[model samples]
Target: MGNIQVALMTVLMFFLLVSLHEWGHYYFARRAGILVREFAIGFGPKLFSIKRGETRYTLRLLPIGGFVRMAGEDPEVVEVQPGQTLAVRVKDNAVTRIYLDRLDERSGVMRGEVKALDLERDLFIQLDVDGEIERYAVHPQALIIARGRDTQIAPIDRQFGHKPVGKRALAIFAGPVMNFLLAFVLFGLALLLQGVPSETSSKVFISGVVPDSIAEQAGVEKDDLVKSINGVVIGGNYEKFVEIINSSAGKQISLVVERKGEDVALKMTPDATTGKIGIYPAGEYRKPSAGETLTYAATSMKDWTGRIFEGFRKLIFGEFKLDDLGGPVKTTQVTVEIAKQGLAQLTSWAAVLSLYLGIFNLLPIPALDGSRLLFLGIEAVRGRPIDPNRESMVHLVGFAMLMLLMIVVTYNDIIGLVRN
Candidate 1:
């Protein structure tokens, strides 16, 4: 793939994965009767946007990450001061819409100076109109229009913090869950496209030998069934054969292969640098039935999840170096290389990436779903929520630290690429 093509595909893949993740939160939040203000894919400036019902779906310029903006999740509040002037649309003596723009000239709109207002609990606005004080009840479904954009007002009941603990936690947890689901589906699809391995025999066949490799120099041909390695009875023990070869790197190894009912003895040395003989193993593959596919997919998910958790454990215990971490640049480089291998490899790589993303989000790190759930757990235990302002500050600080880490990781990736 060309560089431009690789970049575009990488962006598209990220978009699909992130959109699914945020959609999970958006879906559950809506189900919990919380007001979701925006469903944005990517961060930074808006690229495209459209509103449907109560939520504005937006495509942003940067394709790094995305979010589902829920009402009351942000600490910043839109304030209407006592002396501020605004326009309102009334329905049956109740204000159904408030226009903050001064140039709004819609018919039947009442212009007034706000004497007092409360949009959350009281849901009433006392306006000074023509030197007469008037109070109008704000409708529960009132719209707040500003700068040609209309957003529904979120009262206390419609806020995310006010929702039941279970509902709130579900909404927070759904993002990572959806990523796992995507990984499972991707793995299943990849398996369906490329038949699953079905080989289980001690008689390993040499599918192919790399040109100029030690195996080729030693006269190892395709379709040769290895009967023994270095006097060890191979007898279906491919792992033992491999261990012998790896351990005997830069040293000659004897091999006996059965070819056309004849025993052909050969000697070869594994590469000193890589400990590889550059010979491909022959294995049988069979198209999986639906049940087998599901079984294999689930099993693969479980295995990969365990491996990812182990990696996290190593990182947490200081067993991993910072250089071992990969960021977006490394991921893109890997994606480009894998894309050259064929669709099956690319799909499988995507599935693995999805699994990593899912597991990584579930870690109890700040500015992540796991940390949010931690706060909810505390609230549930105490029978009351923590101070919102304090929680928001924690997240803000966490986000800053995360950004710093990303910058360092990205720099390391760039340096690694340059060195390579």
Candidate 2:
């Protein structure tokens, strides 16, 4: 059941994220007057489709990646149907005669000899379209590919690119914006739903300290209330407590504690591995407030973005191991683990994950929305568009790289699961 819950949540997250991502493209494309041929989620064979306006929205079998197929998005794959000058109609049943010059718009001009029509599956098999044709499968929502004149050139209008640079940037940035917003809301709601445990030492004081930790070495013991660190008095900021621990980074620090109505000092080095004293204080209960929620949300954004950039830099510098990365399998595993803890815990995890996703997508990698924005920036500066072919090639390469990374991460996820 745990595994099943993980799988279910994984699917839910994938669908929601994919839908939002594609909607960002679809919204901007339409606003920019770019003609979209298809907006699809997932990849591989199509599982379902729905036609709206000129677009064929599809759901594919694989849930890894998605696409927004726009006119002029790919210049290499456009098919040119050869011109036909003949009358094509129902003869006895089959296409029979070739009229090189006769043209029929409704019924395509006949280019070959017409033969007798045969009845199969309760319909006339007239060897052509425009006749009574029976579609094999009934998919009420199957979207037809919009027809475009082959001879007529379809260009991506500059009106999209003509918008004020700021507006263009906003349109380009909305995807990440939405993601960040989701994260912020989730963070706030989590606090409202499940309050953060207060950091204040209880009146009863410390319960236990791990052996060989900073507290043990410092001569700190049970029934001690940590009054202050370094000269700063500890207050309501749970986040700040963590920050001080991390910032100290294994440095020896002075800790003032109140024990049995007497003040005592303890000096110890912070743990290198965990950066904590290993003293467990009695948990304090507090109610969430508007100010606290806002502060938490803002801090979450700052902390998460910092982590993302740090990871990115480490990855680029070869200091970070790819095996430390994860894919959907790991995400679902983590999400399910948090869910088992309770709704508030799950919500907080979701918020943090959303922020991470937002930051990751904004990295100026090719094949990402950020890359498109980069192209637009170059175009704005150069006073001309980048060579479409070259741009396409770069994106293709980037896409291949991203896929390779995903596969590697997924492999790592599986390996970690097995080891555990």
Candidate 3:
């Protein structure tokens, strides 16, 4: 493919990943009865917007990330002001429409007059954008914060905060959990198609040799097919082949080979470091036993999560640079490289990527699921919701730090691309 096509495909993949992640949060929030104001799939200016019911679904120009706006970040201070409160019919196309209520500010008793609606009766609110009734709840709070906060503005209804600790943790963890689930399913399918490794034989064909290494000195060349080592045929049971080579480590081994339809004999000592005569192996697909398949899957997940935590700890302790972090450009380069290897390889890497995303987002960094969970944890410990202004300020700081890291990573990606 051309450079432009490759770039576009990479960008699309990025958007897809971010969109699915954001959708996870949006879905859980709605399911948990939290009001989602805007659901956007990209960053920066909105390219197009479609208003459906109470939410304005938007598509933005920059397809890097997404956000879901919900209520209960600040205490609601409802007061009588000229343009502060508005009473609209239930049919209005606004995310948070509020009915005015008489407030003493000190008494804390909010009273509002609804033309024909009962004040003391339970009201059913249908939360559907397509005009089809899906779910409904009683109207609990009257005043809603479109934006900004004041002493007159009261805390909004229970949001990511009001839920039980376990429920809050589940809602916060849903995004990363979804990512892991995606990885597991994708990997499971790939395993079913490619089969699990039944043996452990290294590729007999030499792909390349380490320069100036023993293999190069011993006359091993790329594409050379090994007929045997020390008169032992290396085929059939792959594990036995590996065992033979491993047993010959640090000892001179006779290699019988065929190159360009010509028979050749080469003698080489296996490197004690990696235990091989420097040959790359072709991938052999083999059917796996039920236990073997489960073992492979479990091991894959463990290795994936292991790398994630390793990276996380390193980043925290200043062992890694922020520029090592990657953005769309780097991700695209990787995606295309994996794609060149064919669909099976691509699917395998996709599973790995999913696991990575799941773990990364679970980190307690600002503007992420983990950070939100951290705030919820604080609320749980303090026995009251955190101050909205303080919480907002903390997240703002995190968002800025995240953006700065992104800029550094993007610059690194561009530099690396130029060098390549």
- Choose the strongest candidate by lDDT: 1
TM-scores, all models, native as reference: 0.80, 0.62, 0.64
Candidate 3: Cα lDDT at 391: 80
Residue 397 local lDDT, model 3: 93
> What's the true lDDT of residue 265 in model 3?
95
Q: Give candidate 1 misplaced runs (Cα > 4 Å).
A: 1-9, 91-93, 103-108, 147-149, 198-284
Model 3 alpha-carbon miss at residue 243, Å:
12
CA RMSD of all predictions: 5.9, 11.4, 9.9
- Check candidate 1 and list the clashing pairs: 202-236
Give the alpha carbon lDDT tens digit for every residue of 199-226 in model 2. 5634334546666677887798865776
- In terms of lDDT, which candidate is stronger, 1 or 3? 1
Ranking by TM-score: 1, 3, 2
Residue 201 in model 2: lDDT: 31
How big is the RMSD of model 2?
A: 11.4
Model 3, TM vs. native: 0.64
lDDT tens per residue, model 3, 281-393: 44345776677666767778888888878887898899987667778688877898765434555667777887888777877888778888888888788888678688888
Clash tally, candidates in order: 1, 13, 12
For candidate 1, give the lDDT of residue 170.
98
